[model samples]
Target: MVQRFDLAIVGGSFAGLACARSAALRGLKVVVLDAKPDPGARVRTTGIIVKEASDEFDLPAGLMRKVRGVRLYAPDDRALDLSAPGYFFQATDMPGLMHWMADEAARAGATLVYGKKFESGLEYERGVALGDIHAGFLIGADGARSRVAEAFGLGVNRRFLAGLEIECEPLAAVDGRFLHCFADSKLAPGYIAWMVPGVNATQIGLAASRPQRPDLGGLLRRLKAHFDIRDIRVTSRRSGLIPSGGVVHCLGARRVMLVGDAAGMVSPVTGGGIHTALHFGRRAAMLVADHLGDRGIHPVVAMTREAPRYRAKLLLRRLMDLGPPNALINAALMTAPMRRLAQRLYFHSRGEKSESFEAWCKAFEQEPDAKPHLKLLT
Candidate 1:
């Protein structure tokens, strides 16, 4: 017998589970198929969510630690402090959160099947093989390498920074409260290195345009030297990629909708997508719910209304890629009046604006000739 559900979500990551829960709450018979036995281990996210957005997903409060601000470090060791008011969250056990969401979705009347893979095609509105199941609509919450998107001919676009990261004993300067980011010639060419403070350790990692050909070890050595970190104990390590291209069309063909990384919703600047994933996940679930009412996703206003914001950020990112702009960015960041305004603007831009991507775009546009401001923006 072929099993069936009102909606089938492929991939069981953050976005997948969020969709499952949201759809289940709306009374859809949801089924989530994931190939991994332990999906959480494959996560590449550094998992941080703005506080207001946290309430939207109803995240488990105990799983996150509150962070008040972010500290940025330039190549010259010049640092700037940015406050993230009313937004405090850092995940300790990422997989635990995924598992919790999966459980909640199941309890809310969704079926989550592990060790299962999704095969995409036009014929399989509700794919079925080995008597597993099928559905009326399919939601892809998979990561960057989504097979569903590929099978649907949604084709991935543009390269993004590849990263290699290692967990180590806290750096001498890491006080278990501050998140430090580094930019300069020594570590990364276009991307940046981050030192995220964990409860018991730190996540030391670098993201660069090219992961190959340059001294990654030397880059780490430079970070070690610059930070004056010594005798650090290595804990664990992993490497991953950050998606840069903005949203793509063909995400929804017929009764399909893509969410999270599958939709290429990562921020252009910081590569952060946790909140974006949640936001899109909620929206995707709503779209699917509307589809159950015999409506189409495109007629939905949310998708069209948010498209320009994504486009503006993408444009800003493209401009930042052009050299000689960093100086202007730095000037914008360092100016006292702009700094205060930026802080206030940042607070208001939480959730969808956590990365300050669109706002950064407007700033760069206003002073097209300022190189110093570009540095700060980059």
Candidate 2:
């Protein structure tokens, strides 16, 4: 008899591929379904993989460039430049990276099916349709707009932002390797606009969560004008919704589980998910493998154990948005106490969550997603 894949992964995104690779390597068969025939045809999120993620996962080195520093501009034009000694962030060639990862998954034994758009409502039959395909487990790593979430009856990301970006010709005299971030209520109310260097062009974007339907096009124009790059020809345009609600309410129920953006694992304040997506993707598969092998705690209960860490970040996200944007930036980024605390940020690790959150978020952009929080903050 032909071997049936033990897992059917809906979506061939970064997280999904990671899970597929992990499961397949464990000697379990796998299949990954994606709607797009070409993974790189349309980009959504900026693939700013933090150094921690790069070090954690062996991504294709040729598809990445290490960024030197970041330039953050407060709403009042007070610029704060951050460069931790020997710390860096990688700007990935997303299309190339995704395709390469998918290939790696296939090489590890995953059967990839392109142009197969998975619909929601699988849990209506308790995923019998997927079972018919010979998969005993299902992973939902589709995205924030995930059909798998609805299908699994797990609910979806309720607090999210309309994110928009443009890949364009390099900006004038800009340090190509430095990440540029801008904060202003008019352009991005609860979030920020950024520009990161890419191989052929630069990625410029703004994410807004202040309203359910913010005019991201107008905001992009304002951001372009803000940087005086309104004349550059656009190479590509990406639009998507980023979840900021910490972890989803349901991770695994019965034989189905969710990971990546579908699990609302992105950073609430920064809206970056690539790193966490990769982390949880591998982790979810490990949980599934252990469950199938009867070697660990109950999967459902184990998955929920990480809730406190993410919940803390979610609480911090709301607190950050409570104050006036400029005042928050100044008090946190421009203060003397914070200036002294910033020194230990790079030297420390995520396990030591003792530093100021402002320093953690700045470091987070270059490392794996997650802002350190006070144990008593929440």
Winning candidate number (lDDT): 2
lDDT of 2 by residue, 1-378 (tens): 433567889989888999999999987778888888876666787888887899899998789877755666776667655555445678888899988998899999888888878874344333334534656678888999788778768768888878888888877645664687776656677777787877566887887774634445765665555566667778888888998787887776777777888888887866778888898899888887887766566556777785335655577568645534566766576665554433233223322334443464455556543434221111
The digit string of per-residue lDDT tens for model 1 on 70-120 reads 666655566766654235546455667777877888888888889887765
lDDT of each: 0.66, 0.73
Using all chains and alpha carbons, the TM-scores for the candidates as numbered come to: 0.80, 0.82
Q: Among these predicted structures, which one has the highest TM-score?
A: 2
Question: Candidate 2, which segments miss by more than 4 Å at Cα?
Answer: 1-3, 120-128, 210-230, 322-333, 337-378
Clashing pairs in model 2, backbone N/Cα/C closer than 3 A: 121-151
What residue runs in model 1 are displaced by over 4 Å at the alpha carbon? 124-132, 169-172, 210-216, 226-228, 294-308, 323-378
Alpha carbon deviation, residue 191, candidate 1 (Å): 2.3
Q: Report the CA-based lDDT of candidate 1 relative to the real structure.
A: 0.66
- Judge candidate 1 at residue 149 and give its lDDT: 80
